[model samples]
Target: MRVVIALGGNALLRRGQLMSYENQLANIRTACDRLAPVAAEHELVIGHGNGPQVGLLALEGAAYTDVPAYPLDVLDAETQGMIGYLIELELGNRMPFDRPLATLLTMIEVDPRDPAFENPTKPIGPVYSQEDADQLAAEKNWVFKADGDQQRRVVPSPKPIQVFQLRQIRWLLEQGSIVICAGGGGIPTYYDEDHKLCGVEAVIDKDLASGLLAKEIGADLYVMATDADAAFVGWGTPEQKAIARAHPDTLMEQHRDEFAAGSMLPKVEAACQFARATGRRAGIGSLDGITDLVSGTGGTLISTEFDGVEYRD
Candidate 1:
């Protein structure tokens, strides 16, 4: 079986946690411990979120360098390499099988005229107090927005149109190698008039990118490893309930109004896209629940048909 897994940012670094290399690696090792069995069982393609890491690298570069900091697209590529290396190293050490792991410096094509470029909504970097956020915004000339009790930096998150290295990724999967690609939602790029590829200043939502890749590669399963154990209906209300299994159409109709646009909405949308596009099962669940989720006991599973569907083996 083949599977594409999207790792969430908060799964690596929890909110309010100190950002440190040692800490991040430790967390990654723990995640790998839980994922080893899955990797052993399937041809895996791993994708990860880079909201905090890339922002921190950009901020540090700006602080120390005389030249302007690298653009977000460049930072996205950098984090793809950065996070991919860590995961590869840790997973290689833990796995009993000797598997070849490689990180593709992936580029995801997007419309140059995407409206998201004009309106930034994806939050990146560490949270700051309102006072600090305002001051930093003034000094750095960046757009700032309030999120919950803290302020965060917002960046353009354009939708992914295509995976540039889809063929290469497919080849790697066929060879039984665990491939880590599309980190930080891929390095965002677009075509110029001359057909040359050029980088853009936007981030692609990891979930959406993962969905596109899953569909393109014809993977049997798409798994989104998030902080929650299962996707819920009536999410925060008193009637909040977990969904064990549902068709993509059912999920869309039932939870359309309940999901927040910039949060869980993209995940659900991605799962639906993958399921509907390929007629395969897609899962949304906790990172540690991979075994249970695959076994049909954890997370919310979305299928093309809810009745008489067998779990992916």
Candidate 2:
């Protein structure tokens, strides 16, 4: 089956792990250990998150003070190339030499008038002391929001409208190449009043963008491989329960308010959008469960085919 897998940022660098080349390389090797088999069996398109990677680049740029730091769109592309090369290298090592692979720097369009621009909620870069955050905000005219006891830089997260590289991606897949693109929501861009295409100072939700990619590419299956194994109802509580299968609309109606807005909610919503849009299966689960997820035996499968919500044992 044609499959599109959206690898969460955690798949490359888990939380609490030091962001180092060695660590990320090791993780990609591990992820490829799981993904190579899938690529061998089916047409595969990969999308990945770059929150931590992009933030790290921004932080490093901030320290230089030699020139104005590159914009978020540029940093997104950098992470795509940086992370894509690692994944492509590692995944290629396990596959047959004849199988080809390619990574594209995708561009996604967003509405210039999107309200998200007025409200910057997506956090990026390193956390800082309240004083430092305030100082930076004053000096740079940047926004900051409290992240626990510390503060973090915030950027607008607008919806992804169009993927500019769809034809290229489709052509690559037609050639039987394993493709990776749409990193960090495809380098957010939009046309200005002057009708000139310009990169926006924003981030796009990777899950949402990946869902759009899945739909536009006519994928039979779209899965978000996240840190969590499954989408749970009453997560973190004694009544918590794992959902094994669900009809997108039914699942939302029954437990829409249960998901955490910043995390599981987006994944669920994205999965539902794809499932409803195409009447195909979309899954959310841990990266380790990718094999079973493809087979519909693991992860929480969301689709119009299910009767309703079904729980796991």
Candidate 3:
């Protein structure tokens, strides 16, 4: 089967773990081990989140006063190359030498007038004290928002309108290559006043962008491999329940308000969009269960084929 898997940030960097190269290597090795079986059996297209990686690069850049910190788009590309290289290296080691792997630096166009520009909600970079936040905000003309007791730099999260490298990605996939592209939502770009293309100072929602990728590429299954094993209702409470399967419309109508805005909601929304658009199944689950997810036996499968929402024990 042709599959497109979107790897969540947690899959690359676990919570509370030091963001060290060794830790990242360890995590990706695990991810590759799980992916090897799928790669052996199916056509795979991989997209991954690069929030933590990009943030780390931004922090490192800020440390050097010699040059202005690289823009978020540049950092986005860097992380795509950096992370993609690691994934290719690791995944390739596990696969047959004849099977090829390629990482494409994807560019996705966003509307310049997207309201997300007016409201910068996506946080990037390291946390800062209020005083430091204010100083940096003034110095860089950047926005800040509270993240727990600390603060973080906020950037507009624009919706991806067009994935510019779709043809290239498809060509690579057709050549039987495991292609990793669209990290951190394809280096958000747009046309300038002169109709010249340029990068934007924004982030694109990775899940949504990946969904678009899957739909455009005619994927049979699009699985979002994340930290969560499944999409749950009544999360964090005794009544919390895992959703085994759900029709996209039914999921939205029956349990839309249950998902958190910045977390599960996007995953569900992306899955629903792909399911509704392509009439195929989309999954959200832990990366470890990817093989089962592909077989439609694991994860929270969203599709028009499902009757309604069903809970797991």
TM-score of each: 0.95, 0.95, 0.95
Question: Which residue pairs clash in candidate 3?
Answer: none
Where's the lowest-lDDT run of ten residues in candidate 2? 120-129
The candidate that achieves the highest lDDT relative to the unseen native structure:
2
Q: Which residue ranges in model 2 land beyond 4 Å of their true spot?
A: 127-139, 146-150
- Per-residue lDDT for 26 in model 2? 94
RMSD of each: 2.6, 1.6, 1.7
Q: For candidate 3, write residues 1-313 as lDDT tens digits.
A: 9999999888788756788999998999999999999999999999998877888887788789999888889999998998999999999999999999999999999999999999997766667899999998887687999877888887899998899999999899889999999988789999989999998888888999999999999999999999889999999999999999999999999999999877789999999999999999999999989888999888899999989899988
The ten-residue window of minimal lDDT in model 1 covers 304-313
User: Which residue window of length 10 is worst by lDDT in model 3?
Assistant: 120-129
lDDT of each: 0.87, 0.92, 0.91
RMSD of 3: 1.7
